[model samples]
Target: MHPMLNIAVRAARAAGNLIARNIGQQDTFEVATKNKDDLVTSIDKQCEKVIVDTLLKSFRDHGIIAEEGGVQGNPDSEYQWIIDPIDGTTNFVQGIPHCAVSIALRHNGKTEIGVVFDPMANEMFTAARGSGAFLNGRRIRVGSRDSLDGAIIGTAFPTRYRDRMHAYLELFSRLISNCADVRRMGAASLDLCYVACGRFDGYLEQGLKAWDFSAGDLILREAGGIVTDFMGEPNYVKSGNVVSGNPKVLRALLQVCDVQNLPAILK
Candidate 1:
């Protein structure tokens, strides 16, 4: 593993341990609302601090873009660590074990290392730019299912982007009718990891922050999956809209979503 990737794995594990220690204490922790439905808890802040501090200790000059702490370190540096201390805060607060700690190191605008750790399951998914994706040290790959009718898809609720709900529902309805089934696991980072490991044939979502998908994006790509914006372009990280899966499933999803004709509200 690259030294930077090893650092990221260490940081992710540290933060995940912190989160696991706080499980079932949601009521004791002070919760703050970032928006109508979005939330942040003391655990989120503490985990972010742990992750950021851990990374800085090894690479003091690298920049950081974290969920709770925001940006820090040298802004002009070629390397940036993108982190989401708790990818599924709602799930965590609700006593669900679907959340994860996500960390990614981007060099010169491209992700070089990605790590997502789920403490509850003790599963660690990781990848480097050219290295293959892995789960618990075993190499993994996207699912072989190619047809939508046989594919199980993953997606998120448009809770944070109510304005685009109508467009999302339209796509959701079509997917339900066409695919074998659909799932909403509530964590974008884990959703992407699931795709990388073949847990879900394909996944899509919009209105995500950079930290939400940066780590998982690189993992999926290295696992032999395709990731792109709804327009089938490679700008999902910037557009905050992502669709990913094995090559054939991704192509099928883009055609069914008809992203090019999506409503203005979604765009």
Candidate 2:
């Protein structure tokens, strides 16, 4: 593993452990509403602190962008860590056991290290640039399903952005008709990891922040999958719109989703 990636794994595991210990203790923590359907808890803040602290111990000058805490450290640094301390805060609060701690390191503006740790399952999904993706230290890859007929597709609700609901529904309706089935697991990072591990052939969602998908996106790509914006461009990180899967499935999904014309509606 790359040195930075190793540190990322360590930080993610530490944060995940903190979250795991706090699961089912929602009543003990203060929950803040980010929006109508978005939430944050004390656990999220604490976990982010744990991750940021762990990384700074190894590289004090590196930048940090966390979901709960926002930006910290040297923003102008060539290295930046993007973190989602608890990727599925709502799920964690509801005792769903499907949340995860996601951490990614970008060097010179490109993601080079990715780690997503699911504490409940003790599954660590990781990938370093040029290194293949892994699940629990075992190499993993995208599913071989060439089409959507029998493929399981993963997605999440665009609850935070109701204005995009119409566009999402149009895409969802199309997917429901073409794919074998669809799942909304409430965790974008885990959904992307699932696609990497062959549990789901493809995944898509909108209204996500960089932290929500940065780590998982790299893992999926390293697992032999393609990730792109709705227009099949490498702008998902900035656009917050993602469509990812194996080559064939991704192409088919793009066609069905009609993502080429999504920018207008999405905006």
Cα error, residue 218 of model 1, in Å, equals 0.4
After superposing candidate 2, which stretches have Cα over 4 Å from the reference? 260-265
lDDT of 1 by residue, 21-134 (tens): 887686679788999888899999989998988999988998999888878998889999999999999888888988999999889998899999999999999999998999
Model 1 scores a TM of: 0.97
Model 2 is weakest, by summed lDDT over 10 consecutive residues, at 258-267
Cα lDDT of model 2 by residue, 167-239, tens digit: 7887788899999999999889999999999999999887689999999999999999999987788888898
TM-scores vs. true structure, each candidate: 0.97, 0.97
Top model number, lDDT: 2
Stretches off by above 4 angstroms in model 1 are: none
The C-alpha RMSD in Å for every predicted model, in order, reads 1.1, 1.3
Residue 84, model 2, lDDT: 94
